[model samples]
Target: MPCQSSEELNVLVKEAREFTKDGKVADYIPALGRANPHDLSIAIQYPDGQCISAGDIERKMSLQSISKVISLALVLMDRGPSYVFDRVGMEPTGDPFNSIAKLETSSPAKPLNPMINAGALVVTHMIKGNSIDERFQRLLSFIRELGNDATIQYSEEVAKSEFNTAYLNRSLSYFLKQHHIIQEDVEELIDLYTRQCAIEMNCLELARIGLIFAMDGVDPDSGKQIIPVHIARICKTFMVTCGMYNASGEFAIKIGIPAKSGVSGGIMGAVPGKFGIGIFGPALDEKGNSIAGIKLLELLSKNYQLSMF
Candidate 1:
């Protein structure tokens, strides 16, 4: 019932687009820096195959951290909750997404949750495969199926850029390696992880993926359960707790949706049992979330009473 038409959604997008000025594109990844800070787009997907969109919904962007949630779900299906949670904690962190401070201080030394970079690395490590390419291909296949798009692929430019500049990620991997949380070569893991983060798609495809999560992992078209109910619940729980990096708590208070954000200025939100939302606003706030994207979500949530809480 929310945003029943593109015209209604366009008005919201115009209003939220103003916040784009207050943000800046993420330059840390180098390739992600090329995005237009003023660009804003949104797509909403319903279980009944209805979709409403605004802005350039077809524009492709790297998954960035939003890939973390998908990867987490894949690994959970791969290794099961017992094995995965044994290596990663279930709690959220208050530090920056890429911060290494918590790893040193935490008693067990595992990343607090799968949403942060450290935990994401651990989850990526758990992906079942005999080789890097095999693992990455499997993960990609899973993602493709989730979005119902075979054309989904990674941006080599972004992948290479993140792989080269991921010095801090290397540190986290080495630390986890030392603790025996992961036994693979750090470089190899980084290669696969970077590719995982670099997976790219348009906002419409992104919304379809969110729609799967919103529907408890069932593909409405095929009626196939892509992700188990319990696993989907766990992934959604993390999205609520840590999806927006350190700003997750505030995002919850304001937007109140199960959402994940990426530094590429992408947000994937699942409004339980209703619809899925995908947003692209490359301008990022201090916490590395899309500024206009969050504003738009806030507007939609308020207007439609979409908050789960």
Candidate 2:
């Protein structure tokens, strides 16, 4: 049976929360380490604008890897997909987000796609801005327009922690520079990318952001086009092909929605004119996807028949 109300979704959320006991929260970033491992939330925004939310829906968390989708969308809008594609390929790497082996050996050394940290850094550098703050302001403004919420901001704690330990990303940026993949100053580009990943939002706001993609890049509530339809489609396609690190294939097979997950344990899924699902559970599986969040999405997809496949 379809989930008829928030009460039913609440049950699913509770069941999903139980799975967090076996997962581990990301600890690489000190700020992300503080997340409650069992805190699971789900918020779904339908095409008609009705929203149903469950446990811990109001709890705020960093966007983490989930920000990649938004950042890529902004880049695509600012510079067409062809320009963006020149820096980042659309294929899945089948490797961890921070892997550097490909850069050392691959012919071009370009990141496989923008959904990974390496690729995101490249895409961030491609965002036509004169300064780091200009790029970030444009990014934040674009994201806020998608979410229809003006309160979103970067968490200094998270940003500082991420910046302090961003050696892998820094190395990736330098490698991209060596390969002629990144044109801007590596430090400035990485700073912009890290700050973008540190953006904080509750599940409700995230769901609204997903809803824009669900509505084919239009903000359903205000009827404004936040992203062009073709770009939105490309974004969704990349989400399916490469969003979940090495686990994208499994997620696509099982859940069948174009979704992205962050090491901070947030997932954003777009159901193509049906609904946008936002899930947060600070514990993650090995692939860096939120464990409980993925479980909840699977159950919700089964219950609501929301899969695009």
Lowest lDDT sum, 10 consecutive residues, model 2, at 1-10
lDDT of 1 by residue, 1-309 (tens): 333448988999999999999999999889998889999999999898889999999899999899999999999898899999898998988899999999999888998999999999999999998999999999999999998889899999899999999999999999999999989999999999999999999898899999999999999889999999999999999999999999999999998999999999999999888888899999999999999999999999899888888
> What TM-score does model 1 achieve against the real structure?
0.98
lDDT of candidate 2 at residue 16, scale 0 to 100: 88
Q: Which run of 10 residues does model 1 get worst, by summed lDDT?
A: 1-10
Off by over 4 Å in 1: 1-5
In candidate 1, position 56 carries an lDDT of 91
lDDT of 2 by residue, 1-309 (tens): 122348998899889889999899999898898888989988888767688888877788889888889888888888898888877888888789889877777777888888888888888787777788988998898877777778889998888899889998989988888888887777777678889889999888888888888788988777778789999999999889998889989988888898989998899988887878888899999878899999998898898786788
lDDT of each: 0.93, 0.85
User: Could you tell me the C-alpha RMSD of candidate 1 in Å?
Assistant: 1.8
